[model samples]
Target: MGKSPDIIKDTSETLKPVSGRGITVMQGWYDKNIKACHVTLWDLGETDDNFSDDDAEGVTLSVQVTIFSQEDEVELAREIKSLMKADGFSFEGRNGDDSEPEDGIYMKAQRFSKFYESEE
Candidate 1:
């Protein structure tokens, strides 16, 4: 029921408490120049929706997260995934490719989707 931007904002905020220590949380893409631990969120698409005058239900959406770090960030990723799961989001799946764009930047990513219900 929540809009894509709203969901993204919530996700970013949820991750904010864990941010710092050379890591940053952001909605959408982060600046490309600074090569540190960065977390970016994106709304991929809508899956389905069931709505009435009183409420909106079964509304699902896909979200993408890209992590850039100098070393392995599995723990950080897991923390994020756990946070999302605990926040009532469903884990759709994830990708296994990690990249080093330039020299010390290690990049990893995950994708998830969840259904939301809200009063309308």
Candidate 2:
């Protein structure tokens, strides 16, 4: 269970794709209350593509996201999970980020705003 959905909507809209060597994503989540999220990403060492044999080479990126109290942490988490499951969150192949594959996709994120609009 979490505090509220409002509290999870005041963070940064800057979901800039971070790419480089030694970066690692530790956690990721959406908070309902406070209107914000905590994306915990880290930068580790790097390896050559020949040795790593991974997708990207040289620089890598990873992050962790955390949201504060809400009605249901599990439910909220599920929603976030579903979104990431999808392929097209933003414009694909727009930049260094990879585009969604031709495979099927699903939406996990609920219509939760990560920020609040002042009473006009």
Candidate 3:
């Protein structure tokens, strides 16, 4: 099985506390109604396929986490990074330049990767 579902569930749970009035954490796309801020997760892909003699496969999964804030707060972003790191994800790099997706909402995306071996 792919790690996309697990990654999404872990990410959503990890960032749930950060979701509040203006802030929202979701997988794939951000809510249109919540214009204040958004934390979105996207599955980049899986690689490093390995097959063992026992008929088990292993792979590394990559997921991109984009954080948008309307108030231009750095603390929240920092906290999120810390949380992700603690959750066994390594910071790959910044996806691209920070931009304004909406009027005042600033968006910045960071890539994270984790290795998971199939338990099948």
Q: Between prediction 2 and prediction 3, which has the larger lDDT?
A: 3
Cα lDDT of model 1 by residue, 1-120, tens digit: 244436687677667767745477777775667676788888887755686665556667778887877787888889888988888777777776565456667777788776766444
Q: TM-scores of all models?
A: 0.76, 0.29, 0.74
Query: How do the residues 1-120 of candidate 2 rate in per-residue lDDT, one tens digit apiece?
Result: 233222212112222231122222223443223232233321222222322344332221222343233222445445444453342222111112112423222112222222212221
Question: lDDT tens string, model 3, 9-120?
Answer: 7677777668744466778865657766778899888775566675537667788888766665567777778888888888888755555455666777878877777755
Report clashes for each candidate as comma-separated counts. 0, 38, 0
lDDT (Cα atoms) of all candidates against the true structure: 0.73, 0.28, 0.73
Q: What is the lDDT of residue 80 in candidate 2?
A: 44
Cα error, candidate 3, residue 76 (Å): 1.6
- Could you say which candidate leads in TM-score? 1
